[model samples]
Target: MAKIHSHFDHVGSYLRPQALKEAREAFAQGKISKEELLDIQDRLVKELVHHQVENGLEVISDGEFGRSWWHLDFLWELTGFEAYQQEASYKFHGAKTRTTNVRLNGQVAENPNHPFYRDFEYLLSITPAGVTPKVTIPSPSLVIKRDHRSDLYADYYESWTDFLDGLAKAYHDTIQRFYDLGARYVQLDDTTWAYLIQQLETYQDQPEQRRIYEEIAEDDVYVINKALEGLPEDLTVATHICRGNFKSTYLFEGSYQTVAKYLGQLNYDIFFLEYDDERSGDFAPIVDIWNGRDQVELVLGVITSKDPALEDIDAVIDRIQEAAKLIPLKNIGISTQCGFASTEEGNILTEEDEWKKLRLIKTITDQVWG
Candidate 1:
């Protein structure tokens, strides 16, 4: 099994074109059939993939055009989970998100007919010959942590340990299925680790909150490792740690020092870390964990996805060199801090701006890695 490396890659979700959104709404209103809606999505996805190729990206996603939310959509597709409308929305910095949530509706199990596999298949069929089709799913810990309403799962499992056991087996089986379907690279999009970092600042003086944070961190490590157990060595597993992005607003702000120890224990081969601004702190914590581990590479997200501003190429190159001093230059890569749009609304940037940002990423990557 050969290791996979790339100078530049994206964090998955792209802004949804207005036409596709209209088509989805029409389908929901019963004006169009499921086939009609899929046709619209297929056309839009092809255009998005073409743009990715045109921009010089080595890896491509379907732009997540077929779904509403990044993580919730994937979770709803699995067995034993149900999506419902909540009374209140998730509050972000100066913004609010959709009032949607998911819960365990029954005993958890891996659905052999998960829709994401089919989505990946479509992406693979249309991708260019040399380009690798990457699939991104919410990390097992993210799902388990978010859907933690006691009332929702108490009836389904005898204890938290029992629930975790089922969740881990389901994820392990799903990853194997992904490999069997020709997926060589899969990324686990996780924000729980970032949330934990934020909690450290919000509850530093509170002993109870500190204890809760430590417990969740431990569970996160256990669940993620269990989910990745026995995965094929050739399969490239990457984890993207984000601080929540919705319409250019963030849900949390803090440094990575709080969760540095847990991050070092993750089994992922690549780390798509958010480092576009001061909120993410410095690279010293990462340096401590990386410690010359040649197998682990860092995809520095020095470019901001939340804004349309183009980064200075020379400055970006200098930052990459600075990171190289901590980790080997050969193991460094470049990407956006987060996706252009983590949800359907996307950030407050024009489509043209998004393209410019990607082009900037390629330009910086070439100058540094070449």
Candidate 2:
């Protein structure tokens, strides 16, 4: 697999266009047929691909136009999982999302008929010759860590470890399916690891709570690596580690120092890390874990996707230089801290603001890496 050594990259996803959003709502209420809804999605996605190329992004996506939420839509499509209503929505800094979550229906397994496989085919179909069409799904770690239905595990698996293996197998087979379909680049958007960082921080004084979070963190690392097993070498895989992003609100804040050891053990070609603000902390922990791994690129998210304001290019360059003191500049890339829309609700930013963010990144990448 060749490295994604491009100086600029993006966390895959864009704000869902209003037409597609309205079409989805109408379908839910039975005002439109599935075929009609799909027609809107197909048309919107094609326009998104063209706009992405025009905006100068070498890597692009379908804008996740067909989904309600970034991770939940993908999760529910997998076998043995179904979307369920939770009593409380995910708590964020200033917002509460719809009361949505997932639950286990049976022992987790791969669904060959998974919609993402078909979606990836569409993405490949419309992508131009030179641009990279990236497929973003919630990480395998997410499926394991987000399973809150503990009582149902007894009906599905022999032990907790077995359940973990089941989740990994599902993702492993599913990811392989994507690769077989001509997907050269895949990005796993993970909040589990970053959630662990927050847990350890919030529970630092409580030994029991701290222990539980630590144990789950270790389990997540195992599940993730297990899923990547046996995949071909030429497939470029990356993981974007971020705290929850929904409606311009975040779930937690912390340093990578908490999860440095686990980050070192993962087998990914690149790490699309969140460093948009002080919340992500310094790059020393990154240096400690990623040192000497020349094949990997530490793509920094210096620009804020959660807000409409653009970052000062020179200040962004200064931060990259700061990270360069630890990791080589050649191996460091630049991107928005996360996607413009991690969920279909989108961030507080507008479509034009999103494009400006990309243009700013292109300007920065050209100046630093040219």
Candidate 3:
């Protein structure tokens, strides 16, 4: 077991093992009990934590095994939201997800009894000593970005400003709870930053849409920062700007240049950015946001989690050196562009392929940073 002192990390989610997937399906189909399904998830997650340590990872996640979609499950479980089926599923590049999304139904607040609390507890119980247990959930920005609001939102809250205030308070409460639970490393897996940047690009000519998105991005930063204010310095909060990962496909592309103003203002301790392909554009955005700053660390997601073919180690090392010119080598790290699975579908790569990728990241980080 190793203490978490470097940027050698991965986005929290991993490929859900086949047995856990089957157990979830069985429970859905009324073929198994809920307890039985959780038993399977618990067993598989323990194995995942051990697997991660063996691969040289210092931080261990539960692999998001307790739910289906990484963001949706966590959002709907909160106090004032509920899940429902839409007329059509969310369309990804080459795949469409199940027709499920959350809708805000009441005054948004934190549920003192979130299931993730227990799920993270189990992770801590089984995690080997010195390997930091990381608790990951959706960011506060996502509930608003994903359009989980229905007309019913107006019924519970008088104005949009009131709603946002509640959201920030709820997130603050939830994060404080995590700290109390002995969680030092918590990651907010977010797609809102990418969504905002994409929207800015999508509606450049439309003044109204541009203004609306710009406003939303600012509010998003405010909420995240407010939730993170006044926390213990020892708690390391990280965020990932996912560009929609589903079955080896993505929904957003382009650089981080447009959203630098907002990204630079976020209060998180680290940023896990995607640089797996040219679609991520240049590292120029690094300078745009973090120029001359050493208080925060930046982890380059140089490996492609969507693809099984291992990256060339020499090429990867060269790319890292290229980024090091912008930021100090001590404050830089390597990881996959996103998790192996944003949902339970778990990417198109085999589980063995994932281990090889992690090993590559470990080797790259050690050789470059050591």
lDDT of 1 at 264: 87
* TM-score of every candidate: 0.96, 0.97, 0.96
- What RMSD does each model have against the real structure? 1.4, 1.4, 1.9
Off by over 4 Å in 2: 147-151
| lDDT by candidate, in order shown | 0.86, 0.86, 0.86
Model 2 per-residue lDDT tens digits across residues 184-283: 8889988887788888988999999899988888888898899999998888889999877888889878999999888888988889889998899888
Q: Give the lDDT of residue 68 in candidate 3.
A: 93
lDDT of 1 by residue, 1-370 (tens): 7767897989888999999989999999999999999989999999999999999998889988988887989887778888888788886889988888887888777889998888888888899999988989988776655645324666888988888888888888888898999899999998898888877778889989788888888888888899899999999999999899999999877878888889888888889989999989888877755655788888889999999989989888988888887788888888999998899999999889999999999888788777
Clashes of each: 0, 2, 0
So what's the TM-score on candidate 3? 0.96
Q: Kindly give the stretch of ten consecutive residues in candidate 1 with the minimal lDDT sum.
A: 144-153
Q: What's the best-to-worst order under lDDT?
A: 1, 3, 2
